[model samples]
Target: MRGLIAAAVGALIAGNIAAAAADNSFAVRDVRVFDGDKTIPLATVVVEDGRIAVVRRDAPIPAGLMVIDGHGKTLLPGLIDSHVHVFPGAEADALRFGVTTELDMFDISRDFKTWKAQRTSLGRTGQADTWAAGLGVTVKGGAPLEMLPPGMSVPTLDSAADAQKFVDARVAEGSDYIKLFIETLSEYHDRRTMPTLSRAEVCAVVAAAHADHRLAIVHTQAEWAAREAIECGADAIAHMIPDRVVGTHFIALAKRHHIFFETTDDVWAGASGMDFAQKLARDPRVAPYLSPMQRATLLATEKKVTPRFFPTVLANTRALHAAGVPLLAGTDSPNPATAHGVALHEELQILVRAGFTPQEALHAATALPDAIFHLGRRGRVAKGYRADLLLVDGDPTTNIAATLSINRIWMNGYPVDRTLPKK
Candidate 1:
């Protein structure tokens, strides 16, 4: 049904369209809105005080509200990146592509409380609001430790018994969730190996996180490792393995456990020598926004000489989607050949290739991740939701790629400038 927020029928109204840039109280007429879950064809959406006040069909503009023309455009809830590692300038970069929220897998900024406080009182912000895994739990010297800056010694678990105390410390530091690492695949192509927390340790850490009311997002790169983590009650798997075709048992196990996956498509594609970053750099819609470092990193991000596992990975993802497994769109960005904001759109594109409909892919990026991560009122365009929104030039539901043609944007009810940054 259509939800039209139109100008009053020959009655008094307040400000012109220009005023909506500063005022959140406004209604736009004749736009198709994808409200995260479904579409309201030709609806009027009312935003007041940074929140969606009404979403109805054929509704006259309330008195004293600004009205804008929305012909030939589509509106959607601002996108959410289900997986990212927030570094300096990452959030703003993401926002440029209309990604209003980022779920940070790991960061030790110790500013989560500040972030929480800021979002609760939103007026305007350049960066996307984040909830992070303050420190990922790993072995004493394992996995990402080699990738961290020298002298950065994050906490590690020695045994299952200490899991509770470790989670407590993270909670005290204002970590919004728990990230458990498992990198025990010793048979790499290079024959190099990494230590990992034992299965017992994984189970214990998951229990501790649940006890503290936090979701456990496990990092497992191997198929067996992912299945094992689910057996231990993980809330979500951070990255689905690209090493082999996902088995039916694993799919059934995941479905039975009610577990979801962060679809890190670009990571696997890049590892398989797909040149994902170069593809992004070539997109006219995305290239102009790339910073110098973003450009450099996109080309330099991980690349392997010989392609491997990507075909299998694609097959597994298609199977998972076909089996009705919940998949959240995430690009393990800035890894190799991936940038922040733009990578997420590429991710949705990949999901479409993996058999998700354009609307389903949008849900994975918006409402699904927001609701799964407990980010309140941010993923949908329903009444009482936050007014984080994007208005693009065409129908993304049909073109899928039309998301890049951004028209206007609102973050917490404040219009985004979308100018090129000076970075």
Candidate 2:
């Protein structure tokens, strides 16, 4: 009986090992794995189906599994561009740049639904995973309504009662979270009217969003407006205002409220150089992202408008970093000066320039954003995590530029064509 039992136990252990090995079918050999946290030199990452199975250094090779020789390469979690507008133009190239997951912070409900369906289909065809908040909630004659192109929905709330109805309509339309734009005093002056939403009304919208278990991300540019939005229980601030110096009080409040800051410092920097049309358009680096047609439109829109308030912006970004607010990577893409996907990498560079270590800046673009979105399956290289990863030629931890030096992107375990090369 003892001999029989011993044989059975040995067989059971063998079965378990086989199952574990079976789980790790997608393996990359001799690659340096930077698991979005620390470096594992000369490691192998085995991903089965669409999930990570194991990250082992010098582990035994499983039989009959596909392996890619990652010689002189580094493997890291695929980047997440937390804020982007993907309606048109270079948005598809985000995958080529190593942006595997993108969060669309604004777009109309109907359009968002269509985009989401298309993204789902593309996923079946092996594309990047895309998610969004359907159309930002704003006042009837608000900023987005004034700036965005035609066909974009801008639901405006006039009073506190109107705010509640607007919130309900957005939730019904499948908005992931509520986006608000609180007007600054200067903006109110330029528009030549009193701001529509009162403090109480804005607060009501925040309350309504919370009741529905959705977060509220506010587009506020001034210190006072930011404070008001925070007081109303906003979950995040979408931009770092360069117009005003943010004090420690605001930082303390932000920390207390657990508010995440999307420091779109790069967009501001790029937009600042728009006044020098010849310099901006003729420059080789900026030309690819900007078109002749778009430059003509920009020259017409704000022809005489020189770049505004740059020093303050740098200071605001610096202060935010010092304050320890959970910084998020975002580029207001498809905007006048910034393009999609490519611009996100520029944001990472700017963050690194503003005193962030390469690791921290990369985290903002990868692991941190996933954590912010409560996306459990995406980011990191652990068992059960999504196989969204980038294979690069050099170690990105040593230099920021190495982050964009992509060899290939594995989206849900399928290779993405970097050059959009012909079949």
Candidate 3:
């Protein structure tokens, strides 16, 4: 009986895969284009063979191309979340809110290779494209181990050799980038401490990643750890500092090093109140795109009562941006009050509230991540690029909230099914 059930499930999965690869050509006409840098008032975008073939004003529509009327709509590159710990069902939920790409900070799944292949294949649809750091490098009793299952061995680096070995193993496993956990855990649990990677070890790991031509990103919460990560040659900081306000000197260092920061203020804000999550949960515009599981997660109560850190996070983000340090918008989804996909929209609002112009906030989620991570042919609406695009009803360049008014989403030129299934 179990074998029969397994076979049936496998067949259903295969059928869905086949259906996702069916459509790969279309044209969206008469839409305002946000080409990752500036806005074009009126333009036509044509997609053929899963690539954007033409983007111009008054272009002649070739015969046999499915034309989608984009009058009174805004076409932008699909959103990208730079920091997320993905599991099953996350990608589909991400796509529902027009997030066509998710940059996973850490993933431990054994089937990661399979998922990566599926995301890269031409004509793929339904789920967001994923790039991940297969397994984060951390100390034995450090962060993430507390959240992971018992007896699961995580690489603990105490020396430079260990760091090199760990990075090499991750590279062999096809990790897109290297993720380092530099958390101290003192703030999360009072009077308790966790082991952290030494500076030498971190430097070694970063050097190894650079030697392999991969970016090294670090997860840190305190200003001190963030400074250390930067000093150790980390290409990016995965989370904002929440313990205290960041100083201009630190911002200058980040700017000098060309280090990008991912603002995860939503995760911190969710703990103090449900405002962010509740707003999305109550939003009628996004209601149909959210799955049952995503809706429930968004509405769930906060489990941990950590000190309010969003204020500090927001202030630091503002300071960093003012100092010319590049910022990337990310919501640490499925963490507590934050859900997948929709939380990114909230993050953009937070950025706007924290002194970023709406256009800058939009670029943080799109072009910045692509440029920093070297994700070629994405995060832009241009000819010779993948047809990963989002069509919204309003001008998001001026009003960040307009991103939520999602009308259509295309991944590799294939339209997404926005309707939720009936229970």
**Which candidate number would show the highest TM-score if scored against the true structure?**
1
Q: Candidates ranked by lDDT, best first?
A: 3, 1, 2
Report, for every candidate in turn, its global Cα lDDT versus the true structure.
0.84, 0.70, 0.84
Candidate achieving higher lDDT, 2 or 3: 3
**Tens digits of lDDT, candidate 1, 1-423:** 122335452222345445546776778788899999888789888888889988887777889887777888889999998888888888888888899988889876767876787668767887778778878899887877788888878778989999999999998888888999988654244776778899999999999999999999999887888988999999989986776788888899999999889988877887778866687898888788777666776777453443666777778789999998889999877787677888888888888888889999999999998888889889999999999999998899877888988888888988887777863
Residue pairs clashing in model 1 are 3-43, 3-44, 3-56, 3-57, 4-57, 4-58, 5-44, 301-336, 301-337, 302-336
Clashing pairs in 3: none
Distance from true location, Cα of 379 in model 2, Å: 1.7
lDDT per residue for candidate 3 within 124-207, as digits (tens), equals 567888888888888778877788777777666667887777888898988999998888865554766778888888888899
lDDT of 2 at 177: 78
After superposing candidate 3, which stretches have Cα over 4 Å from the reference?
1-22, 304-307, 421-423
User: How big is the positional error of residue 235 in model 1, measured in Å on the Cα after superposition?
Assistant: 1.2
TM-score for each prediction? 0.93, 0.82, 0.91
Q: Write candidate 2's Cα lDDT for 1-423 as tens digits.
A: 999999999999999766544442468898987776667788888877767888888765668666788888889888888777655433455666677777777775345565557444324223455677777776677756666667655557877777767888888887777887776445223555435467887798898888888888888766788888888889988887755677888888988988888877765665566333344445454445344333443233222323554456677777777788888888766565555555666778778777888788888888888787875567787777878888888887768767656776777766665544332
What is the Å distance of residue 408 in model 1 from its true position?
A: 1.2
Against the true structure, candidate 1 has what lDDT? 0.84
The positional error of residue 138 in candidate 1, measured at the CA in angstroms, is 0.5
